[model samples]
Target: MIEFKNVVKKYDNNITATNNISVKIKPGEFVYVVGPSGAGKSTFIKMMYREEAPTSGSIIVNEYALENIKSREIPFLRRELGIVFQDFKLLPRLTVFENIAYALQVIEKTPEEVEQRVSRVLDLVGLSAKRDNFPAELSGGEQQRVAIARAIANEPSILIADEPTGNLDPETAEGIMEILEQVNKQGTTVVMATHNSFIVNEYKHRVLEINGGKIIRDEEEGVYSNEDANA
Candidate 1:
């Protein structure tokens, strides 16, 4: 579960990425954070994952209060959170298996454990056949599947994604969306920030709309569009 209380983030340029945002996401719930570019969606996700600190207020992710958490304790907090990015962020030279395994390895998982977990996640994402392929060798959607597999390799309690399907064609993006839905069904909380109206309208879920650095709407089984996001 995640909760934010009057959170604020202001950069040196005096641009406030997020301001007075408060919301809660329970375990196993799927929510979409929809907004146009520069609407603070990225900063909201970053704060949840501790990539950026809030300028004020509190953020709690699965019971860890991020306001005063030491830098050394971030890894432990991240152990319970999985992050996916728009870029796929895969190492060009590493094979699918290695890419996922590296995540487990970072947490000191043994080789045997790593191998088993990686194998399971690859199959989960329907990428078992591409285990030996590198990022460059795969199609965009396939590469994103590998990235998803890598993120869930640790069995994190929550999955946080930023523009997860931003790069793929609509059909390919739909495929990625299916995988994310499947993952959410299996009980991992999913928080995604997206601008794709088709996907948002088609796949009903909780929607939180942000603009001018604050959340203005939260609705269940919500529908969203870029135009509506600017309101």
Candidate 2:
């Protein structure tokens, strides 16, 4: 579960990335954060993951007040959250298996536990066959699958994906969505930020639209309304 109340984020020179935004995502729910470029979607996701601190207001994720979270405690907070990015953020040198295993290793998991968890998640993402491959050796979608595998290997309670399908073809993107949906069905809360209207329309889930650093609309089983088509 995630909750934000009157959250604001401002950069130097008084440019606001998020302006007094409040939203809640319940457990076992799937939501989409929809917006155009510079609409504060990224900032919103970053705040949830503690990548950037909000300038004001409060954020409660899994019952921990983010404003009161100490710098030394961020790693523990992140242990309960899974994050994926548009760029696929895979290391070129590490094999797929190693990449996913690295996530567990950082948490001080034993080698046997790391191997078991990484193997299971890779199988879940249909990347078991490609575990020995490097990022450059895999296709875009495959690399993204590996990235997803890495994110979920530790079984985080919440999953936040930013432009997860940004670089893939339509079919590939759809495949990625299916995997995300499957993950959601298994009880991980999913919040995906995307600009793809076709996918949003097809999925027909809760949609939150943001513009000019504020959330403009939140709808259940929503479509992409083009009110800010020119924004």
- After superposition, the stretches of candidate 1 with alpha carbons farther than 4 Å from their true spots are 229-231
Question: Which ten contiguous residues of candidate 2 have the minimum total lDDT?
Answer: 222-231
Reference-based TM-score of each model: 0.97, 0.97
Candidate 1, residues 1-231, lDDT tens digits: the string is: 799999999999999999899999999999999987898999999999899999999999988999999999999999998899999999988899999999999889999999999999999889999999889999999988998999999998999999899999999999999999999999999999999989989888999999888898999988887678555
**Tens-digit lDDT track for model 2 on 130-217?**
8898899999999999989989899989999999998999999999999999999999999999988888999888999999889999
Q: In candidate 1, which residue pairs clash?
A: none
- Whole-model lDDT per candidate: 0.92, 0.91
**Residue 158 of model 2, lDDT score:** 98
RMSD of each: 1.0, 1.2
